[model samples]
Target: MTAVHGDPILTSEEGPIRTTEFESIARAVDRETEGVQVELIGGRLGVKRVPDGDHGRILNWLLLLLMPLNPGLFLHVIGQGLAVGSYRKGRARPDGILAPPDAFAGAGEWASPDAVVMTVEVTSHDSDTNHRDRVEKPIAYARAGIPIYLLIDREAGKVVVHSQPDEDGYQDLHSYAFGRAVSLPEPVGVTFDTESLKDMGD
Candidate 1:
């Protein structure tokens, strides 16, 4: 496949703290906060929105499809932060991470993506979704060498499957409209039935 193009570069926001410091702060915030989730992306601090009911419904919809098809893989939620981006400088908590059961055993807050096959992101009804989910996340996950990145875009009402990761970015990008059957690529192959999501994500 031709290289996917036009993905904006993931740039830092000139943080006063380094990635190491952000880890400490991120943990403290996660401990203190109730609903929100914190992340360090592109050398900047970010707040992942508290998922709405529909946001959760989207994930649950995926859970049904993923489990039956891929018995060997498991979906890890519950704030599974990953060491992502170049040199693991970025920390991102994907909505769902696909890996073997107990893959994160004995790991800290931000686990390695070595055994992870795919990272799932469901867009929330928030202003930051564009930058966090659309632009920076694909780059971040790709840089982490994750084989596949599945995006359930609420705003666009589509499902985007990204695969063939390299240092620069994902080499293949396939997008399907809601209700259309979307086939995710290898390493974590699972075709998606997004029909239930047709009216959700509003």
Candidate 2:
């Protein structure tokens, strides 16, 4: 991650509180404070605790399952931010994001939502996290015109594949339990195995 200069002071009492600007947040994301994830929702900043070990296991499994089918595409795990909307009103970093390798070749800091093919989010322990991933993200992803949004709801013990994006969110949504397989749509024509996801409970 490249260092971003220009410190914008948010408060007089605190020294240089980071601004909600996408670039500022992106620059602030570093190894020293990797546990806190930053996002721009409706042009406002929203922070959340990163997912834990079990969340990572499921993400890894998904990466392994998808990478082989489309070698030209790149699968980005947590930390990479995606800029969405015309005004760049929102910047979201999904649990997993799949896009063409050259999509952001020369771009700096973030990738536009138009370049994204798919996004995945695994539900976390917090209700706010659940609401963001489950409800907010789908709407945002759809409005931004992403083709697919896959969500692994750990608390609900199910996997949901959302596609056919429209003005009002995904037109198609398919839900399956942990052991069932969910078929991805065109551009990524494959069935994902959810058997291993059962281990997330352990």
Candidate 3:
């Protein structure tokens, strides 16, 4: 497909963040018009991108592989996708985002961050890779009123959960480790079996 015009130019400390603003806009427009399955992230009208690297590819593959083990979960593997707004500006595709289907009102296409109940970002090789997810992403998610945020640390083998958004990011913070079950609120009755992820990045 041909590219659209007047799209925002998105850049990051790492370079062009994978997908371009026009491409993302095109996807959004296509979702709106064609009524196909599409998901978007809108904040500060900025671009969110992730590059194709060993870290990104590895984490993405791991998430995709583990997702099937839990058929009840409807997660979005937003690798090299977009999460706009906040201090750490640029393209940021989390390792994977655990967003359930029931979060939305109608049974149609997926909406942007506003429709998102939660987001997840697994740490990459470089500390810089998670700079946005660690700080700005949570801030942005809270600002957008998203209820939850998860940051999985591959290096530390720990998962951090943030909930209860307020004036400054999430008001509640909790941590979980492998073999432990994590309970998800809202859209109701959702739980994540994180033990499957224990084999990730090994």
Clashing residue pairs in candidate 1 are none
Q: Which candidate's lDDT is highest?
A: 1
Task: Point out the higher-scoring one by lDDT: 1 or 2.
Answer: 1
Tens digit per residue, CA lDDT, model 2, 1-202: 3222211112122113222445565556644555566665444445666678998888888888788877877777846778763345567788888888677677766667778889888887764665577777887788788999998898888999999987678999999999998898977778867788888744
Q: Rank the candidates by TM-score, best first.
A: 1, 2, 3
Angstrom error at residue 185, model 1: 1.0
Clashing pairs in 2: none
Q: Please list the C-alpha lDDT of all candidates, in the order they appear.
A: 0.81, 0.72, 0.53
User: What tens digits encode model 1's per-residue C-alpha lDDT throughout 1-202?
Assistant: 1111212223356456578887887677667756667777777667766788888887877776788899999888777889999888899999999999889999988899999999999997666778888888888899999999999998888889999998878989999999999897788766767788888856
- Measured with C-alpha atoms, the lDDT of residue 118 in candidate 1 is 94
Q: Candidates' TM-scores?
A: 0.90, 0.81, 0.55
At residue 18, give the lDDT of candidate 2: 28
The parts of candidate 1 lying over 4 Å away from their true place are 1-15
lDDT of 2 at 66: 81
lDDT of 3: 0.53
